[model samples]
Target chain A: MGAVIYDRVALIGLGLIAGSMGLRMRADGLAGEVVGHARTARTREVALQRGLVDRVCDTAAEAVEGADLVVLCVPVGAMDAVAREIAPHLASGATVSDVGSVKRDVITAVGPHLPDGVHFVPAHPIAGTEHSGPESGFPELFEGRWCLLTPLSDGPEVERLARLWNALGSHVDVMEPDHHDLVLAVTSHAPHLIAYTMVGVADDLRRVTDSEVIKYSAAGFRDFTRIAASDPVMWRDVFLNNKDATLEILGRFTEELFALQRAIRTGDGKMLEDYFTRTRAIRRGILDAGQDVDVPDFGRAVLRKGTAG
Target chain B: MGAVIYDRVALIGLGLIAGSMGLRMRADGLAGEVVGHARTARTREVALQRGLVDRVCDTAAEAVEGADLVVLCVPVGAMDAVAREIAPHLASGATVSDVGSVKRDVITAVGPHLPDGVHFVPAHPIAGTEHSGPESGFPELFEGRWCLLTPLSDGPEVERLARLWNALGSHVDVMEPDHHDLVLAVTSHAPHLIAYTMVGVADDLRRVTDSEVIKYSAAGFRDFTRIAASDPVMWRDVFLNNKDATLEILGRFTEELFALQRAIRTGDGKMLEDYFTRTRAIRRGILDAGQDVDVPDFGRAVLRKGTAG
Candidate 1:
């Protein structure tokens, strides 16, 4: 266990990200006490039963009462409501952060609701699985993963939150809120939407049938299914909250897709080959950044349950 | 190792599939002696040095001379040429099969080239890594993977070839050529094209620099990079040869994507949530079918360089 970073930390949601944070914090003794609140009583029961948190509170307000660190782990769409609910109860010098994919929206939603003394630091951990809920979290989900922090003001609280994420086994980087949204639109948001659309298209295709698509998924569609299987409410909120950036990326994607479609229609092998080669270099860069390994089949077998570190 | 399935097997192109097949066949004693041929002498040398084959032949005809089974493992666009090259050398009663993603194209390209006495069974193994070439093969690549065999005439030769694949640790199924093309368009071909297009779009985006996309790829774009990093020549051949099926699936994908885009533009949260929920079920079916695992992160770690079996 590492040195304690917070006296008491409250997570406003008991889903995958929050549950994982609680588990990792407890595992490493990053926080003296880890408290959490979920909207549903069933999730709270599961959190307590699964040892995801030291204690489960009845409401977001009660959960943040004396917590020095309060992380809003609710869906992006619900950030403002949850922030307002817990604002009056925030500790005197507490730091309020989040684990949302889109940063700009979170800033706009949760910023005004937070009290003046409470520090607001918007953060996005570039780590997750398709699974959600209290039972779907593991301690090492953030290890070797990037957690981006986009702070409104460069304050000591931001550094403290960075240290906490470091203690949680993440490499943290500070970025501007708008830049974070645009980068995520290119990296996470748009790719996820595309995956969902492709899977939906496969479902709607009568000629292929659903069973055949599932049966032959190992070919390539299986990867898309994994991404598409992520929490529905969470993704819905992400798309709704990050509308402008997501739409911009999607627009670029559609244009490129059309160009490639034209090339395919005209049987232009050269264009296809050139485009594929340039994109291959991007994978190499990701590997070089240590974000992933060099294995060909995506190193899939090692990151599964019971095997992950 | 099991009993030998073929006394002598000849592999036409020493790429990923052929190399994996040769290694798996030898590891399981599925074939007595595996002979291989590649377009380049360097690949032929790598094939023998890496022990992917027992012997390396300079030409395709020389490789197929006395073999009981000759498997064409070249790209889809080159199948016709390779089949013609080895046609005269195919032994009497020998079965010639292929490992192409598109089956209808393979049948049209290689069917008439085979002599009357020789059997032609087109097959595609629904398994691969982004890495290609002779040195990339491994013995366990085909274990628990599906191998589809599309035979022109359902003869004993088809059964024998199926037994060979079975011994190589693959579950074999017979599918019609056109149906195979359609299924692949939905499962493999279309998904690959989509991934490539997404990666291409990211590369073309001026707002998000290439390095940022690579550094933050742990989001979802990394998955597309893996798919896009596949051999350019092979993908070029796949798109060109499977034009009709791929274009059809692409049209369907575009329609679905436009609907989702409209929903996002209109701020229809319910539509997004319901669509995501439906796509989530497809993933469950794939996991239930044992085509993939329930492991959330795609089990990526186990297949890394120093960690895999």
Candidate 2:
């Protein structure tokens, strides 16, 4: 086993991210003790029953007491309230971080409530599945994934937090909070909102029944449904928090979509083909960077017996 | 082996769908002979080399000369030209079908060019990968997928075509041409165009570099890239041919997106949450129908060794 990076690590929200972190840390002996707290008693019980933490606390303040590292894994809208609850109980020299998707809003929501001696380092792990809650996490969720840390100060505390994440099988990169928010807006928030919008549109269509959409989803709509099934409360908070950047990207997307729609109306195949070809190059770049597997259909066909070629 | 459904099957345009059909037919001995043709010599050579066809003909007319079953697997835009080329060479009492995504336009474009003795049964297999070309096909590609056949007449010819698709491991359903186009516009055509548009917008963002997007794609944009990377020519033809339905759905999508955008701007979390919750139910319905696998992230983590939980 590896060396323990922190003596006591407190997870403020026992959801997918925190549960995964606890599992990884415990499996690798990366922390001396992993304690967790959730807003609901049922979640706390599940976190304990599932071995996601050594002990479950009923209150956020009780969870953070005497901990050297504290990570907030709540939805973005709840971050401020959790921070306010846990601020008085945090130990001196404790490094506080978060796994929120938006960095700037998280920093704004969480930074003010911390104590003077605590080091506040905001982080966002760029890894997840559509499943949520404490039971949906696995130890390898962050393996080979990128964990972005937007630090307020570059100190030993920040380095220590980065080392902990690295030991959990994630590659850590530090970015400015504003730049990180904007980047995630382009890459994650906008795409998720677009998927949700498209799926909602399909569901709302009177001409096409839900049964027909579900039966023939393999055509292309299946991908959007997978993305749209992500945690609704979390996504709602993400959009509310990262409003500016998401709005900006969506504006550009609508403009580009309108141009393609016009091309279709005018039967301008060349323009549509050219635009599609350029976007294809971006997919090539993503595959080459090892961000996604190169398997066709994300290897879904191979998962079923007798379907692999 | 299964009994031969057709004495000879001719595939005009040796691409993913046609090549897959040839492989399945050959593997199951469902067709006595499978001959293919492509507009380019390279594709014809590859089709023969990959054993996707027993014989490779240079021209569409030569391929369909004595075949009892002729399947046009070309882009929607090229169906008219291919139909015109093979209309005079079609054997008497032969059945002509297609695997085009847009049914109404394919019916309109190829219906007039067929000989009076020929039977035109337009079929669409609601299955594909982002990959294309003859080399990218497999025998199991159509297994457990849906194939919709829109026939001009309910005759023995249509039943024969349906049986052929069933033998190839697909469930066949017959629908009207106009309804098929509108259903596909909601399920396939509009989602594809939206994915392409979002990927294009990300590619055009000046503030975010390509490398950043690629490195951080696991958050959500990876799914969009996979959908956007589909064959440009095929998608171009799909949009051009199904313009009315596609445009109508896109208009509805834009209106919904604007409403969500307004909610985000006004911090109406309840509206956003309600909409997201409703869309999540559709995903649940799709999962229950067995149309998509229920594993997290489409079982992508399982595909990589040492990453599965």
Model 2 residue A260 distance off true place after TM-score fit, in angstroms = 1.0
lDDT of 2 at B91: 98
lDDT of 1 by residue, A1-309 (tens): 799999999999999999999999999999999999999999999999988899999999999999999999989999999998999889899999999988998999999988778888889999999999989988878877889999988988999999999988889999999988998899899999999999998888745364788877765688899899999999999999999999998998988899999999999999999999998988888878887767646544334224432
Candidate 2 lDDT, B23-111, residue by residue in tens:
99999999999999999999999999999999999899999989999999999999999999999999999999999999998999999
For candidate 2, the per-residue lDDT at A187 reads 87
Name every residue pair that clashes in candidate 2.
none
Q: Determine the iRMS, in angstroms, of model 2.
A: 1.7
DockQ of the candidate models in sequence: 0.70, 0.72
